[model samples]
Target chain A: MPALVVQWIVALVMLVGAFFILLASIGLLRMPDLFLRMSATSKAGTLGAGLLLVGTIVHFWDFSITTRTVATIIFLLLTSPVAAHLIARAAYFDGVPLWEGTRRDDLRGHYHTSTHTLDSVVRPAPDTEIPEMEGDDFPEEG
Target chain B: MMLDVLWSAILVMLSAAFVLAFIRLVRGPRLPDRVIALDLLTIVVMGFIIVYAVRSGQAAFLDVAIILALISFVGTAAFAYYIERRV
Candidate 1:
């Protein structure tokens, strides 16, 4: 392909990537809680960074850089969600409060303090109404 | 010529985004919020580095970007663990 065309392509891709990054940052700034911010950053930030790397790959179009770019993209795709999950899990277990408007939290009663694990047995049935608990149905016995 | 203009424009927007994210990172009320902001800042920095690499025609910077992504991923995960374990 022509150099000019390649350059335009790079420019376009980079612009789109930059837009996503900006959107993610805005969401991060404005979102109410840790979970919402995590949701924003993980998805938009990954796609934005991936697109930027894609622009780099297209610009270089060489063997080594291409390999590295592909590796970087894959690493990002794999790790970002994992990182978000870990952080959100930590926040939840550490008792970070959710937004007031959050309707249903499936994991609310499923977590076992004794085992430090989620008891999947109490997993709410699909389409079943979530009961409003008074407090600590499963009492912590230490 | 046009490509240079486009890249420069994109770089300016990215810098603005970075500054806003930094503000959030500094002012975030909670630990996880701060961590999320930190993650965004790393990504923006990576984007900046890649743009710089493109401008300078240096493939070495791409290598740096890869290393950065690796380090940030690990760092974020470790921090999350510390928050959870509280140790």
Candidate 2:
């Protein structure tokens, strides 16, 4: 590849990658609701990173970066849906209402509050902040 | 020469995905929100890795890329499992 052509290619790819990242930010900030936002986050991030990684590979073409980028994409593909599912499940279990336009919530009746326990990690940020840790004694053993 | 053009084009498309994902990552109202973002971050990193491989002409890095892809899945899975199974 000619130096001029390579330089042009690098510049173009980088610009495009940067633009996509910015767009994801916009979607994150502007989206109206949680599910919608999560949708954007998962799909957008995956795509954006994929582009950037590919760009890096094209520009640098090293073992470390190539491995890192591919790993990144594959990881995103595997986990994004799983995490989304968990979050959605948690939201449903804890009684977070879906958007008003939503027509059905089948899980509401099927999975009662009694069946699934709500862990803090699954919980969204609560309105009131928890008080700071107070003095506590260590456990004693016989 | 032509290979480089195609690769660059792919990056352009990937960039779009990155921003959209970032948007959601930042605005998510729950724990999974951050997890989702982090997950996306890994993907974007992967893209760069691929691109770097092309530019630097290091064929060996592909192996590392594969490993990263594997580990990231595991990391995400662990979190998912914790969220699903934890008391």
Candidate 3:
């Protein structure tokens, strides 16, 4: 393809991608309900980031980068939903409460409430040490 | 070349969808709402990437889209797990 034509095409791609990102941010800011908002944010953010990076790959047009980009996109699709699900579930458990007009909470009366205290809400247990980062702090190694 | 033009049109449409989704994200009332909106943004990003790949005729560009999708998913899952944890 002519260099000029390629440049124009890539530029347009970038332009559209950026607009999508802005929209995603807009959704993050405007949604009214917790669950609905998360749904919008998760999908839009993932898609927007994916689009931006893809534009980068196109602008470069190299095979190695292409492979890497493809892998990343797949990864995004795989993980985005799982994380979204976890967050939604957690928010519900933490008693964030559904929107005022919610007609139903499917989980209501369906699951048993847990008795375990959630001390790990903000930080992990101090005794649960991380691997390797323990470094010379490990007396045996020292 | 024909596909390129067609895809550009598609991209424009997707961009509009993105705007609608964003309005919802902003109006949300809680942290989860924000998080979810962020996640949705990630998806819209993926679509944008695809359009780039198609428009530039750089099929390889799809690779970045794949990776972004994966990394963001991990971020969301970790956050969710943390919030859901009982102890």
Candidate 4:
């Protein structure tokens, strides 16, 4: 009876995980922009993978396998958000256009292309003039 | 008996998901779109590896899944860096 119950639980967990993964892939296909796709895939993909790892732990009921499964889950959870953020920030700076339906973009006009800096507030114009350095501050030319 | 059927169904669903993600990878109009598709593909492949490990009763394969996850994260980060640094 216990074995039967375990089987059912594992099956249910795997089914749900697989469904979530499939939903993420579908979202990746259907989303209108890179950011939207990242939003869909990163969250759903991590959850799905984590759930599947949990199912593996339950199915095996072994100590080493459980440890590895937990490690994989933790790593996925830790890295997925960072990876998504990096990709999205890069994509935005690389000029990947947003969807037409996107109503607001707070980062627009605040990002300095040359310096790769972001200002908290949009400046009237990017300061192109280099402030004159004092004699002591300026390095001597070779 | 039922467990066999369920596993097979899950595998099929994952394969379909992989196909859909691959379609996006192929049809991408921009590099980021392709990168996102590749990331999704790695995720789907990870799920596939985990499911196979469960089905085959080979705990060894779980290691492969873990390594794959690590590699995918590294690959995504590298691609992001490349995109950011592009002239």
| Tens-place lDDT digits, model 3, residues B1-87 | 754565566567667656765665576555566556556655666676666675566766566666666666676777677666743
What digit string (tens of lDDT, one per residue) describes model 1 on residues A14-113? 9999999999999999888888888888999999999999999899899989998999999999999999999998888777877766665778767664
Clashing pairs in 4: none
Residue pairs in clash, model 1:
none
- Give me the displacement of residue B28 in model 1, in angstroms: 1.0
Give the Cα RMSD of candidate 4: 10.3
lDDT for A106 (candidate 3): 43
Give the C-alpha miss distance for residue A93 in model 2, angstroms: 2.3
Error of 2 at A110 (Å): 3.3
The candidate that achieves the highest DockQ relative to the unseen native structure: 1
Better of 2 and 3 by TM-score: 3
DockQ scores of all models, one per candidate: 0.77, 0.23, 0.27, 0.73
At residue A10, candidate 2 shows an lDDT of 61
Q: How would you encode candidate 4's per-residue C-alpha lDDT over B1-87 as one tens digit per residue?
A: 987889888998899899999999999888988998998899899999999888778889999999999999999999999999993
* lDDT on C-alpha atoms for all candidate structures: 0.87, 0.58, 0.61, 0.86
- Candidate 1 residue runs with Cα over 4 Å from true position: A121-142
TM-score, candidate number 4: 0.90
Candidate 4 - CAPRI tier?
A: medium
lDDT of 4 by residue, A15-124 (tens): 89999999999999999988998899999888888889999999999898899899989999999999999999898878787776665666766877776789888763
Which whole-number lDDT from 0 to 100 does residue B1 have in model 2? 85
